[model samples]
Target: MRTTKTLAPLALAPILALALAACQDRTDDAEDPQSASTSEADAAEEDEEEPAPVSILRPDIEPPELPDLPEVPLEPLDLTIGFPEGGMELDEEAKATLEQVLESEQVATGAPIVLRSHTDSEGSDTGNMRASEKRGELVKAWLVENGIAADRIRVIPFGEQNPVAPNALPDGSPNEAGRARNRRVEVAVVPVPEETVPDDPADASAEDAD
Candidate 1:
């Protein structure tokens, strides 16, 4: 009986050893897939954290700088309109000159226009003043009829006081040519007032939007 018990324990020992070895192999196999999955997840996370490198189509070449343009000053217009001998009316030549002047950039900006009218020293001072005033009114009326605002025009009658040429020559003779030049209206423009700019950036932006 003692011999049988010893033999039975020895026979069962190999089976027990085999079962423990099988369980150990299965555990290692299962843990290997989980470890591989964890390694793959860590590799994916690294890829997400790193940013891709930017590719430049033209890294060596740079754009050229443009030159600044020069600013030109806007000068006031100084034009003249001459009348025929002893006539307060504007002839075709005078009209042509006025049209050309009005087309100029200096005069086309709707600025205040000054018309200084003058006459030759032919009549009395009072008569010359009245005639010069009449001539100026005629010119102003014409301008109003042709789309110019009446308020924009200012007529100043100089009469014979500001004659371009002497009515009589140095030898006390009538200088017809000089007298003819004296009957004219000097046309000029008032300079435009400069605009005030806001110092605040927000105010400037609001003005731009407006």
Candidate 2:
């Protein structure tokens, strides 16, 4: 009986040790739950507090407006007068044509007209130059006699230096027809600019009073 009582105490010692270890493990598990929950909550809060990234694209810019310009006057008329064959005098048809051109609305309004005369390569350069000048002066005189203002006309004489026809004739001789064709006058009218016109005196006075 004494031996059995000592063996019973030895067996109870192992069971008590096991029970203590089990209690320690359960305590650690219970403590870990709260710590894990706190960590998860912290992660969620950080996600909610963060801002989204912005774009790098910019808005389009607009162009500025341009200012308006003042208007210019209308263009003038052009008139071509051919001289007679082998003659320096103005023909009847050419004179009539000149009269008609001068009577037009553009020339009547005192618009500036430029008269350029040319001669063929038939004559010497010096003679042709003189002829061109004479033709231009004659036309100017005719316009003046027909009531056109002298100030509104300008004359330029370009002799054989500028030929409309080639120097070679059909028969291989210097063609007089080409020379005659070159010996002509061209009239060009140029309109005045709107800005050059004088302002009304009444409008200026009214603005000053204001």
Candidate 3:
């Protein structure tokens, strides 16, 4: 038992230490489950999905053409009624026209109408003026009898003036058509004022937001 033994463990000690360090690094990685799971999840996400396709827009779109709107007539303000010489009464035709306007909501709006009377220059200026005034007075009286207020009907007497047609022709001959046109009264109707309506609160709020 006195034979000498060889020391080979010093040379193997470095290799054993390196192997033990490598095993310790693997043991630490295994202990951290979150890191292994995160790596696996990232790799799986890259392998399982792809980007979707996108659409390109064109600049050639256009809106549809609109239809034409309907045409409407304008409201008439005056009504011309014919009269006989020195007449103060309204004819049936004039009465009917007046009644129509009175019932058409124009008088209901509380606005006034004008009675412009005329004559045919057949009498003295003073007499014609008096006759014209009488004509307007008669018309006003008729309207008052038919439920219209006297204050709302103004009288304007244009005696033998503002004739629509010539009283005489170029050769100085009497023109009946001109005289007939001159004997008239124009009733000027006042339009009713439009009533203002309130907007809905919700709609107003929406408009305000915009």
Candidate 4:
């Protein structure tokens, strides 16, 4: 009976040793930051996969070539140009109008262009006069550059002397449209003398045929 009691104590000692070792392993796993972080990284990596590359199929036939567009020719323009307030630049519409004037047949005949430039009542008399003259010179320069004879262009600068439109409203407030209208350059073609018929026989025969 004494021998059996001693064997029972040895058996209990091994069982207690195994229980302690299991508890120690569980504590180490809980305290390990690297193990916890590794688990989190693995979970994140499993959430998504890389996208596949896209493939496009090319067309079997070639495309046709586009035809060039025909350009419309410019005509004559006896324009009244409205300038931006105090600006020397001619806007798109004004430039297009000038193109028409340049493309006219009469312009090629060296017909004189009378340029009447005026300014809005917005500055001192002398300043307005100078600015208006400069504007006139700019227009003349453009015309001369585009093949119009320089001597044929007559520049007349009227610095706020003749207001085509009222510079201000009845309440003394500035009228923008009026001011814009006042700042203008009027263009007109000078007339040439009509020559007498020299009695051409060919022209007379052609007229008789008509």
Candidate 5:
């Protein structure tokens, strides 16, 4: 019995030592400093990587304003004119009227004045047309000599075909009085709108603001 008890204790000694070694390895693994430090550093890095909040304050700005403009005055115009008797000639009265027309108002740039001449039905159509054309040319020449630019005048001839008189006379022949009236030249002045002057620029701006 004593020998059996001593052998039994010797066999159990190896098993006890193996169990204690397993317990010591588990304790060392639970308390590892390198693994614990890595976890703490990862948590700190995640907290530091968060983004900052945005601001909402904005500055004030103003819009641009438009400038004002002023009104302009209108000018008066005349139309009536006269010529000499018995022929398509510019008498004293006619010349005076023309001079007034040229000086009283601003002769707009690029405006054309049409000068039309007519003749009586007393002559052939061809002859009357030629005579009327000559009269128109003569009038154009006169205007050029009187300081008006030649380019501003347009001459046209309308003979017996276009008369301001009646075709029949008192005795049924062409009326001499009517024919005489037709044997005249007419000058029609056309004013150019673009060449007209406007109000002063400074004055215009003031009016616009008001």
Candidate 6:
């Protein structure tokens, strides 16, 4: 019985020692500033590392309004008709070109046709003018014969005054090619202006009655 009692005290001694050691460790952890700071820092880092909640909603947006662009005016019909060297007569090529011109919408619409004739600088001013006039006359006659009204045609002879190319080269030599290009007629079909009528027909009638 004494031996049993002594063994029980020995077992109790080991259990008490373990409990004391556990208490000491808890006390040391509470007392240490570095341990407490490290625990707090770990908790703060965990909170900081957590991702924020995201929204699935999209923002409403609109495209900006654009301004209206102005209308562009149509250009007049303009073309050049070349003539043979020292000839006021129309050849097959010239006739074909005139046929094409006659087929144009401007010609069909009865647009006023202006024929401005030009000549090379080989002849005198008076002779060149006369030649240009004759050239213009021949083209006018052809147009008139092809059902175009004579009143709608206007002929303006420029002779050698308005040349498209130089009559002579830089070295004072006659430029035959340039002179050839210079001898031609410029045909322009001008657009007729629209007659402005009163917006209100009744008002126009009233004014006429007055």
Tens-digit lDDT track for model 6 on 1-210?
999998998889989999999999999987899977989999999999999987665556555689888545336888878885658778787788888889887777667999999999987999999989989988999999998999999999998999988999999999999998988888899766556889999999999999
Give candidate 1 regions above 4 Å deviation: 1-70, 199-210
- Write model 1 residue lDDT over 60-176, tens digit each, in one string: 887778888854657888888887577877999889988877678876777898899888988899998888888888888888888789999999999999977778988999989
Model 3 TM-score (2 dp): 0.54
lDDT string, candidate 5, 66-173, tens digits: 777654432544433333254556678767766766764445443577877887776688988998888788777877887889988887888777777775677888
For residues 76-169, write the lDDT of model 4, one tens digit per residue. Answer: 3367766855589888877887887787765765668988899999989998888788888888898888877788999999999988899999
What lDDT does candidate 4 reach at residue 135?
Answer: 83
Better of 1 and 3 by lDDT: 1
What TM-score should be assigned to candidate 4?
0.54
Number of the predicted model whose lDDT against the real structure is largest:
6
| TM-score for candidate 5, residues paired by index | 0.49
Displacement of residue 79 (Cα, Å) in model 5 is: 5.4
**RMSD in angstroms, candidate 6?**
11.5
Extract clashing residue pairs from model 4: none
Q: Candidates ranked by lDDT, best first?
A: 6, 1, 2, 4, 3, 5
- lDDT of each model, Cα atoms only? 0.85, 0.82, 0.79, 0.81, 0.72, 0.87
Q: In candidate 2, what are the lDDT values of residues 130-188, reduced to their tens digit?
A: 98899998899999998888888899999877778776666788766676678789988
Task: Show where candidate 6 strays beyond 4 Å.
Answer: 1-74, 199-202, 205-210
Better of 2 and 4 by lDDT: 2
Model 6: which residue pairs collide? Answer: none
The numbered model that scores best in TM-score is: 1
C-alpha RMSD for every candidate? 17.9, 12.8, 18.7, 16.6, 19.0, 11.5
C-alpha lDDT of residue 115 in model 6: 98
